[model samples]
Target chain A: DTAVSQTPKYLVTQMGNDKSIKCEQNLGHDTMYWYKQDSKKFLKIMFSYNNKELIINETVPNRFSPKSPDKAHLNLHINSLELGDSAVYFCASSQGSGRVYEQFFGPGTRLTVL
Target chain B: QQQVKQSPQSLIVQKGGISIINCAYENTAFDYFPWYQQFPGKGPALLIAIRPDVSEKKEGRFTISFNKSAKQFSLHIMDSQPGDSATYFCAASYLEDDYKLSFGAGTTVTVRA
Candidate 1:
């Protein structure tokens, strides 16, 4: 069974287009996160939601919006995509926030903006 | 914008040998340090983690060495196998914003059989 999963495994779109990626978790996790991995393999957190409430919102652009319909799902929507937005977007879930919790990652959605 | 810095962008080790990857951070506020392993086309998986209060933590063949004074931490994979070949990322998170992980640039590890 898949603990965490993301849709649109690979997305190729032109600049100025809008797209959305969906994520879900079956691990009964309370916290979900969105991270971006750049071409240099540097992973950074973009946003986090806990129990359908927004928590951690990093220095990400306003064009990126994260929505959590429930504790089981977190969806990311990007507006007016740019060439720099071409990277792998990962969805992760954890039981909670703390040192005791281990985050589980889903197979990333590779978004390529041309 | 990256807080944690990892070294040896890539390394090749032989089977039965040890694979070491090191990371350093300037922010001492980072209390929790964790190591993750990611294979191509797959999301990263947590291998092990350590807190600054301790010097080292080991699990199975993976060991995390933490040097709080020097602001450095390293991951050692003992008895390295070809299956261990993948990209390794060292991440740090603080208590206040514990859920947000600041990951370092990943290191590619290739273990030869």
Candidate 2:
């Protein structure tokens, strides 16, 4: 079974356009996270939600928003996308918020803002 | 600021050779350290992890050597094979928060037969 899954493996849109990426996890985890990987391969956490509650919001722009409908799903929506938004976005989940638990990641979504 | 720093952004090893990747963390609060492996077009998978309490951990051909005083850790792959070629990431997290991880850039390893 696919533990964690993401939709729209690839997204290409023009500048100023809006896009959304959906993620789902079958691991029955309580915490979900969204990460951004730049071209330099630096992975940074953008947002984290625990049991549908927002827990961590890094210094990310307001254009990016994360929504968790339930424990099994978390989605990211970007508004007024810019050239800098061209990168891979990954979704991950963990059984609990504790550092002792291992996280499961889904196939990343490559977003290209032309 | 990069919390976790990794060395040798890339590596090349021959079959049966030993491959080493090093990482250091600045935050003393970090107690959990993990190494993840990622293949092309796929997400990273947890390989092994270590806590500050343990000095070393071994599983199969992969071993993790940790130095709590130096705030450093390393991953060693024994008898590397071509199948081991992939990108490795080192991450650190503390128990204070929801276990948010701070990751190093990455290390691309190519094991040639």
Q: Who wins the TM-score comparison?
A: 2
Alpha-carbon interface RMSD for all candidates, in angstroms: 1.5, 1.1
Pairs of residues at least 3 apart in sequence or in different chains that clash in candidate 1: none
The residue-level lDDT of candidate 1 at A104 comes to 97
Q: State the C-alpha lDDT per candidate.
A: 0.93, 0.93
Give the C-alpha miss distance for residue B99 in model 2, angstroms: 1.7
DockQ agreement of candidate 2 with the native complex: 0.85
User: Which residue window of length 10 is worst by lDDT in model 1 chain A?
Assistant: A94-103
Per-residue lDDT tens digits for candidate 2, residues A1-114, read 958999999999999999999999988899999999999888899999989999999999999999999999999999999999999999999887855788899999999999
**Over 4 Å off in model 2, which ranges?**
none
Q: Please give the TM-score for the first chain of candidate 2.
A: 0.97
Candidate 2 global lDDT: 0.93
lDDT of 1 at A28: 92
Estimate, for each residue in A36-112, the C-alpha lDDT of model 1 and write its tens digit. 99988888889989889988898899999999999999999999999999999999999987545899999999999
Residue lDDT tens for model 1, B1-113: 67999988999999999999999999888888989999999999999999888999999999999999999999999999999999999999888766478888999999999
